[model samples]
Target: MSASGAKTNLHEFVVQENEQVAEGLWRMRCNTALAAELAPGQFVQVSVPADASHILRIPLSFARADARSGELDIVYAVVGEGTRRLSAMAVGQASTMVGPCGNGWWLPQDQGRALLVAGGVGLPPIFACASMLAQTGVGFDVVVGAQTASRHCVGYVDELRSMGIHEGCDCARKVVLTTDDGTLGMRGFVTQAMENLLAEHTYAQVYACGPNPMMAGVAKLSMSKDIACEVSLERMMGCGFGACSCCNVALVDGTQALCCTDGPVFDARRVQWQTR
Candidate 1:
């Protein structure tokens, strides 16, 4: 949150695993010391090697970091030319990256039970969030939705158990899932699942990440339930260090904030959601 210096720390990363997790989602693991500084909801900006073929670096949100092992894991969806090249990176090859950039989520201790909702690639950051919530000793419910179940992994549940969340049966059921094709659990949107949770429990706060549309739905649901919520944002950037003005964002309050430096995580009420 310091004003004005390059927050991005440049490093070289070797591709460990770049496998397709679902239809359009890819789970990528990289080797870097940046794992120590990275937190849930933060991201790394990676340069797709310098060449005529690809010069731009794509911004990817960090799902989790293994500080002891010096490894960083990210989940990204193929969306543009840069991502296409990145998705095809072979194991052991190196990629240049700069980060652990952007603001992360804040877990208030007084906030009772937590509710987490995610869509597609956005589910990555929330993985670490579960650990953070566990550290507070508060019970949390996480719900993720996708187009299919081939990408499903309940690693979050195991993580919470590791952190000592003793809510046995209920916590196990906390992970409500949905797929558009009915491949796994519920056959609907993430919002529908969130709505159901909201109806059952008055969440202390809500956290979400996903496409703008999904985030918008979460914002509306949070407002309806009178729950404070925060979201991790994604934006196009020329430089992840805040040197370039490419990632500027206008919040709902008419104040301009830098997505790279000010936040990738913002309170749901602060974002300019309706127009985006």
Candidate 2:
């Protein structure tokens, strides 16, 4: 891995495994030398080679990366033809990827309590952050929400629970699962779950990745509670690099930034949703 903050180049990865983890969600693991440098919240743009009509690559956040093993995994929902093509790929398939794009979640120096909020496909980067936090002594909690338990829940929750048990840490015990149908967890949104957590304990910061409304709700809640919060922004990209101006987002400061290069992550308080 390069030194911290060093730029990474595009690299072709060999698909090692691809499988459906949920109803429409698939997790793909690739072997790449770039995996050694990818951080939580950083993403890769994958080319949909199987579909000739789709010229643009789809952006996906890192679900897990092992520097030692040179392996990186991405979990995504097959929502379109582009992703459907990715889902149908076989092991040993080759995919061209340009990544560790944008910024990742910033970890606090002190080992204070942290809160992570994720919904649907947004769970990938949050899951990666959880793995990083688990290695530290930082106390943390995760609020995972989806439309339904059977179809929407990301399958890594069990693995996280097992990790907590093996490590003997309480981090995994605090995972709060919520669903609209209440099939497996609280019958409400993840923001409601955050409300419950905030009522019980104080956190150093909150990190969120999800739908716009969901993330905006988390941001509102964090602002009301005076807790620092950062959100990962999702936008369309003609080019994963800053050359394309397709992913511009307005900031509270009356300027615009590119989600591709400037950030897929931004301070929730500074983002001007009105301008979007």
Candidate 3:
């Protein structure tokens, strides 16, 4: 077992489909046994084939994993040369991935309603987090944000709505969409929408993933409410394991934790939020 308490393995995968789901965002579905081992909030390090010069594997979090079908869905943004190369990978192309890395989201301890927040490409893991909550029959509300209408992952929003129709929940589930440019949905940051939701609902826990400043805002709100919160952090990792210290997350306790081995998910209160 690795430091995250999950078994890590190197597996070969074949691309089943790779297509653009939104502006600068691509969704890739691959067939691999690693799908069976992946859990919500965990990430994988994928080796982009035919790029010997760019040796570092592209670390990606999955949107969905189906063990029965042996398929994994990853949604990523084209931010750099690595992701650009990954988007160009053709159907049926094969590559190697090291996965089941890091810890995953934990269920709410108090068993009341939960709140989920995602910004930009962070929707992938938040989608996974919603799936976990749905499977466990935990009621939840979601707030998703993007730069503009074209950048939003509408499919994930639809999926979240469907998950809300569970037999176990009585109250209506809220799924709020926000965009900074006001191209679609609510015209503001996710924090604005979350503020309204927090006012209307009593929550047991909060889970978030996004840019540093955005997540810092979320952490502040959750802490102010005295609600337990977990956040999936993004970092530039050199080695997906613990061999390198590239992905260090500063904590409130004045200690640094490795994002690869110690987290990608952590308690929101433990993180030392940096303001812009």
Find the number of clashing residue pairs for candidate 3: 0
State the local distance difference test value for candidate 2: 0.84
Model 1 CA deviation exceeding 4 Å by range: 1-7, 151-173
Residue 61 miss distance in model 1 (angstroms): 0.9
For candidate 1, write residues 110-229 as lDDT tens digits. 568888888888887777787677666667888888888876655543453355445453444377888888998899999999988888886888889888889989999898878999
C-alpha lDDT (0 to 100) for residue 89 of candidate 2: 85
In candidate 1, which residue pairs clash?
none
In the range 179-272, model 2's lDDT, one tens digit per residue, is: 9888978999999999999999988889899998899899999999988888999988888888879999889889999998878888898888
- How many clashes in each candidate? 0, 0, 0
Q: Considering lDDT, where higher is better, how would the candidates rank from best to worst?
A: 3, 2, 1
Best by lDDT: 3
By summed lDDT, the worst window of 10 consecutive residues in model 2 runs over 1-10
lDDT of prediction 3: 0.92
For candidate 2, the per-residue lDDT at 221 reads 92
Pick the winner on lDDT between candidates 2 and 3: 3
Q: For each candidate, what is the lDDT? A: 0.78, 0.84, 0.92
Give every collision pair in model 3. Answer: none
lDDT of 2 at 255: 92
Q: What are the models' TM-scores? A: 0.87, 0.93, 0.97
